[model samples]
Target: MQALLKNDVFDGNDGCQYRVVKTSSPNTGWVINLSRAHSWPVERDFGVLRSHSRVATQSTACAKLPDFAFYSEKARNRANAAYEVIKPLILNADGSENDDILDERKRNRLVLARADELDISKTTIYGYLHKWWSQGQSKYVLIPGSARNGQNQTSGTSGRGRMPGDGRYSVFQMGAEDIKRAKEFLEKRYIKKEHASLKGVHIDLIAKHYSFRDGNGDLVKRPEGEHPSIHQLRHVLKTLFTPEDVKRGKKGDKNFDRENKPMTGSSLEEAVAPGHIYELDATIFDTFLVAEANRHHIIGKPTLYLIYDRKTRLIVGFYLGLENASWTGAMLAILSLAEDKRALCEKYGHPYDPAHWPADGVFPAKFLGDRGEMASRNSDRICDGMEATISNTQSLLPITKGVVEAGFHAAHCAIKDMAPGYEPPMEAVKRRAKKYHLDAALTLEECTSLILGQIIKHNTTAMENYPLSPAQVLAGWNAIPTQLWKQELELNGCAGANYTYDYLHLQLLPRTTDDPKSKKAKVTQQGIEFENCIYKSVDDDPTVRQWMVNAGMGKSPEVHCSYDLRLVDNIIVHDSKGRTFPCTLAKDSGRFSGYSFAEVEYIIVKERRAKKLLEDKTNQAEMSRRQRAQAITTRAIAATKQAATSAARSARKADTAAERDAEKSRLRRLQTSMPPTNSESKRVGNVIALHSSDHVEGCAHQQPKIPVEDAAERPRSTIDDLLRRKAQEKTNELTHL
Candidate 1:
């Protein structure tokens, strides 16, 4: 015979099932009739007694309890309230009924005392106790008979009426025919692309069906009291279709399917272990960011690509950049999955122990992402090289990658309030003007640090509602992503694939030669040139050197290469034999280092525009200067030609070398001895005047005289002395002749 355990159900020889609610002794216990009928006499049996003799003859079976989830909140509350009334009598400290209360007189006295304190009859309290003891000794069994029947307690409109305080409106009870008509009107007019209002549709229904023609054969509205209210129509509409169905009708199938569809399964359903499946998705952050080079220049919101582990809910990898959602950004994010977490965190200035984020170098068996990135032809590298399958979500349906989508929301919420240049809500924007870009304070690197911190926090913190497997629960594994990942890896023996970072990076990076539309990198005398930036062979690879030699020999060698747009510092150049060579940015292209390919391209374009504008202004100034010089030269040439006409050619020729020299000397001396010009005298006089009242005295008429000693001490001009010496020599030559 099986031992009678507390709460164990057993079959008695009397053809009734009993539950052991309490053990009174080693061989005896108090039992309750689990299969008791409502018509059974409660007082005739003060519960049942189970002994060793009864257990020896009876069979035991597992008890099947009711699922209270289906019960309404009111029903559950009523059951709990009734249980509170008899709790002290039935339940002891350890959840078993007290043996002292097993006596009929003692139990009745307690019941009567409870009834009197609660202002209820003793019979009512007895009924609650009998129901609790007869129905498996559960609080759920204390629910009222009407609620347990699963039928409306009141029959046919007994409790149905206009709610209290509803202004003098008449209550119009809708019949079957009225309901059918209302559903038709709602489906045709309200729940449609037109999105008609409920009140408007109700009015239209009245105009079409409930209205009568007036004396002049014109349609007229019926009295408000005679028609059903809009609320009645709305209630009928709700009964005919669910909220999702109504949304589908109004917003079209695609919108409802993407946003309003019920999620019956989890993103982890297909994930068997920590790295079984990974979800990838990208979103443009709401806040703006400044450029790493120049904080004054506002770069529009950066796009964040997240690689989320479905099984552990860990953010394995991410990429933050100014680029839009494209394959380039996705490639970087995928590379981050196998990147060193310690290095990545340190690079972003959020360093922590590797144990805190242990998803480094773990590759998922399958990659799931949106069509924008995963659907590209470049994504084939993930399948062919890494041996992983790519699963792309359907277009416009972000819910397919719901795990990563929620991750983006979590990351955004973590930094939204703290981040500078955060975009205000649409309602706030509508209320007042705001330029979020102008408020941008964080650089691209700083934003990346913030996002990294949030990811680390998420990975280390225990997640809410993480569904743990039975094995994990038995082993006491925590819900923290890092802990779950490490525990699962240890138990399951590493479900993720493994590859070196360099090897995987090379395989996954997009190849320019593979793209027909993109220009391949050309090897020239300057080195391998890509995207207008020169990449020289940093490592002495024979293949790269040969290519450079051939390029210098006038052969344009086009090399197949893969490069990360996020980092233009280096690129992987593939030789004809499929061997790769590392190439670094040339000295000339060193300015482009530390900048993304998009930023490099932007810088090039901007610089070109600025240079062109400056050149245009320079050319305009040069042209203006040339025109002014031409005008001055033309005027001087005309004056010289006019003066030549006034001189006689024969008289000029008759003059000897001595006379010519003497004439030049006399002119030089006369010009030097001449008094200062009126403008010059006035300029000097103004300086010596020194008084505002002496304005007239500082004019050309009041020129100051130089003293004889000062004038004599002033040496003759060099030109005048040289002329006098030349004239004396020329005159001596004439006398000797």
Candidate 2:
């Protein structure tokens, strides 16, 4: 007992100092010697503030304060007013009549002298009694009129208050008419194709109608008129209409939905333990990350995929990369959740004691996500393999899993006041009308470190409405998740849920084979080529290829290969049992060697941006080339439809100037062969009949062939007839001349 003599001073929850009168056994607790009667068992030795005040109401330090019933100061003030006004009526007898006596006094009242304690009058006390008696003595009915029907976020003045939607003064006795005109003007003048200026409404009002009217029936313009003042009207509009009302239909649908979409559906069913329901969600982090090679070279915003714990408001795992929400990012996050993060923290130079982030080996019974990546085919197979059921939330509804959504909100709030390199929220971006990439200052590694620190800080923070801090849920008291998770694992076995890194990795990735049913990869001595890159099998010997050939169902069985789309550097090779035997890469994979999938995509995206800028000017030449190709195609199409008979007819037309030259050359050859018959035979007329058989053959192509019976029926004896005909033609020509 002597040990408690000097250090017997104790601090109560109300911040009061008390002397310990007596010690007690462990179960009974200690007793405060002070008449205040504050006694309780000691909690964790985290230290508490001490105060000299006896009354808890007098304590100023929050550390010295205790968790108590939430008593409204406004309600207490009303109660005090009612008590002051009703005290005299409860005991209005003379002072000599023992009105202050407790034994002979009124019920629920300590004394009538309490009225003099506060500034109360006998007349006011009588009024309060009459009102309470009229309202059946309801405690709420006794509230002061001044404090009744109070609302927050409204226009309430200290001494005098204006009605809602009113400016400095009450603009209108009613709200409907004033609100109607204001809304109509806002919709017509502000929300338009040309986007009328917001201030135009004031100008229109001034030009169209004045505030007051004169005795001569002329409109008068005065500041003290009946109509609302310019400033007051502007205030009303500000209080009523938001920027979204004016900017609707002028922005992307997704942007609008993100900002204004209503949250629907209840949260995921409460789970029994940790990892029973893993909420998977992803979003574009509102910060720019830079490349390692160039600090100022921003890589735009990165997508952050989080595996959140629903039961514990704790983030189980996350994956950040310059890729969109796809199977690769989702799988990477899942893989991170299943593995030990000690190495991960060490790689980032973070002081990870594993006492605050106990997230590994917590296999989920079900995975919850929205329609995007959660509905993907690959995600379905991976979750199935892990014995995790997949639940897809309704489209555009992220509130179905409020824990993760709240986690994202917490993260953004933590970084809202950070330095440059963080992207502005949509409102700021809309005002500036530009992206925040140019303002980037944080490198990828630096931002990642900051994020890790935030995750740790958030997990350790003591949250309200929770049994324990997120860290302590898995850890012990004053211990975080990192330590608690390991402690739980040590005490309890695997709990029928465990997976190896290799096994989980293979299952999370998509697979394709060379089988006839599937688009299989061809196995060769060099390697298997996929995604414009080669992936060599470490065991691609002749024996393996032959085994693939002979041990197959069909004539030539194909090799099944699985690869992570985010990294083409390597792919896992699956044997007949679907077990991964080797991880391989291209033989000469110079540039692509050990490159992340996002890095490759970055290169392609950068080049495409450059190409687009260049093409705006080069498009004319490209158009011309396209036109030329199209013209040639059209001509070829027309030529293909030409008839063979028509083409031969045109080819046989050798009776032009070139045909005459060919005839002369033929005649010269005939003259040489016939010994010229004489010099006269070499003349033009004799050259014509030199080869009658040749003339007949040349004319045969131009003439139509008649049947032998028709020719025979025409005429016979042509020699003498020909001589008579020639003589007759000569005689007719002379007669006609």
Best by TM-score: 1
Candidate 2's C-alpha runs over 4 A off are 1-269, 433-436, 465-496, 513-519, 524-529, 532-534, 540-543, 547-554, 586-737
lDDT of candidate model 2 versus the reference: 0.60
Query: For all the candidates, what are their Cα RMSDs to the real structure?
Result: 24.7, 24.8
Cα TM-score per model? 0.49, 0.44
* Model 1: residues with Cα > 4 Å off, grouped in runs: 1-194, 197-245, 288-300, 347-351, 416-421, 424-429, 433-441, 513-559, 566-570, 583-737
Q: What does candidate 2's lDDT look like per residue over 1-737, in tens digits? A: 11232114555556455443223432222323232432322322212323232333222222232221233678666766675555454445563322232222342253345556666654455456445433323455465555443432343122332454635455432245554565566566655434566567755664454456679987766453344445555655566667665455444345456667666534534554555678888888888777789886877888878777665566778887877888888888888876767887887788767666666656677888888888977776655578778888777656567778877777777876884667657745476566667778877677777777788887776555545547655554433434434444455332325677666887888777433554456554445655556565577655455644554534444566777776677777666765554546655654777677567667768878999999967998899999999999999878866634555556656568898888876765554322233446557545633444454444433444566876789866879699999999999999998
- TM-score of candidate 1 on Cα atoms, chains taken together: 0.49
Model 1 residue 79 CA deviation (Å) reads 40
- Model 1 lDDT, full chain set: 0.77
